[model samples]
Target: MTKETKKYNKWIVILSITIPLVVAILFGVKIDAELPVFLPPIYASINALTSIVLIASFWAIKNKKVKLHENLMKTAIIFSVVFLVLYVAYHMTSNSTKFGGEGNLRIVYFIILISHIILSIAVIPFVLITYVRAITNNIELHKKIAKFTFPLWLYVAISGVVVYLMISPYY
Candidate 1:
């Protein structure tokens, strides 16, 4: 492996541990009152924005606008970070929302919800690896992994919004 690829090993290690620990801590922590009530809608909009940015970035890259794609990806990452912070903040201050959907839609909801949950966890390392590759000037590996990363990240982002919609009524 090239030095660029080797350099990313640290990031891979850091993210591998950081993400699951963060998830575990956040998941274990519970909140009682709903202070800072604006977090839900804000994070939901961030999720939607992340999805839009990801699609737009794909289009930019397809048109050979590398710089545009870079900017879009950076923006998408920023939005995702903001969404995560807001999500954690909201969760830290409010109770989890209960799903209210019923009947056939419940199945649909659960599928999306489950996939989103799983992908959300899976995408953490993918996102870190993909970005590390790019930043390390390992374009070949970056492109290879980006194809995998994009859809997973996009799905996670889009589903965050869907989950909010499905559960917001109970909140």
Candidate 2:
């Protein structure tokens, strides 16, 4: 196998095992009573920032500004990291937010929610693969997977905001 292939395969194994295990363990762990409440807007804002940066990164690459593109991608990754940290922190501390919508819009809320959930889970492997391809200098393969990754990431970000807005009332 090519060196890049071997590297990526190793990364895939590590991340594939690590992420889900972390999620599973974290998902069930209980926290202290009377946990501090975090403002959802802040986390939602991070998601918005991620989407904006992703779009800017796309524009940067389209213009062949490679360094700028890399910086933007790094910024996007940072935002994603920050978001995840806060998200898990919030969930661990506070009770899960419930959907408080009533009527037709309730359906709309759930639709957004279901899509958000499925896309969020789906995005994990895509992001890992996309990152691996880019880091390994497999630009051709990266670009091919990127077209899929970008939209899915965008959907996740946008839906994050949607979910926050929908559930904020109940929190």
Candidate 3:
């Protein structure tokens, strides 16, 4: 990594830990003010958008559209950050909606939800490192990590929407 990219190493570690920790901490914090609008569906939509952008980015790179790929990747990251902000804001303002499905569907919901949560937290560093590699013009390493990062991030994004849909009725 270049000196400039090396600087991001500490930030990547800091953000990888701090983002999830802050989200978990904030999840328990409730404010008395009522939100003007519901946020779950909105954030879920953002997740869906992120997934789409991620897929597009993959396609862009495959088609040799390097600049398009880069731009789309950045857009995906922005969507994820926006989703995180909205998710935290919503959780702080409202109680979580419990999943109400029964039978095998309940099991499926939990399976997806658990995997989604685990991967969402786990994908943070991969994403940061992948982005750093790409932006630093470390193309070979970027491609290597992107192979892993893409799927994890895509699953996290898609599954966030799935979890929301599964529990939306309980809201």
Please provide, for model 1 over 65-93, each residue's C-alpha lDDT reduced to its tens digit, 9 standing for 90 to 100: 98999899999989988887777878777
What are the models' TM-scores? 0.90, 0.89, 0.97
Q: In model 1, where is the ten-residue run with the lowest total lDDT?
A: 28-37
lDDT for model 3 comes to 0.93
After superposition, the stretches of candidate 2 with alpha carbons farther than 4 Å from their true spots are: 33-39
lDDT of 3 at 78: 93
Q: Candidate 3 on 13-65: residue-level lDDT in tens?
A: 99999999999999999998898889998999999999999999999999999
Q: How good is model 3 by TM-score? A: 0.97
Candidate number of the best TM-score:
3
Per lDDT, what order, best first? 3, 1, 2
* Model 1 residue 83 distance off true place after TM-score fit, in angstroms: 1.0
Separately for all candidates shown, the number of backbone clashes (residues 3 or more apart, or on different chains) is 0, 0, 0
The superposed Cα distance between candidate 1 and the true structure at residue 101, in angstroms, equals: 1.8
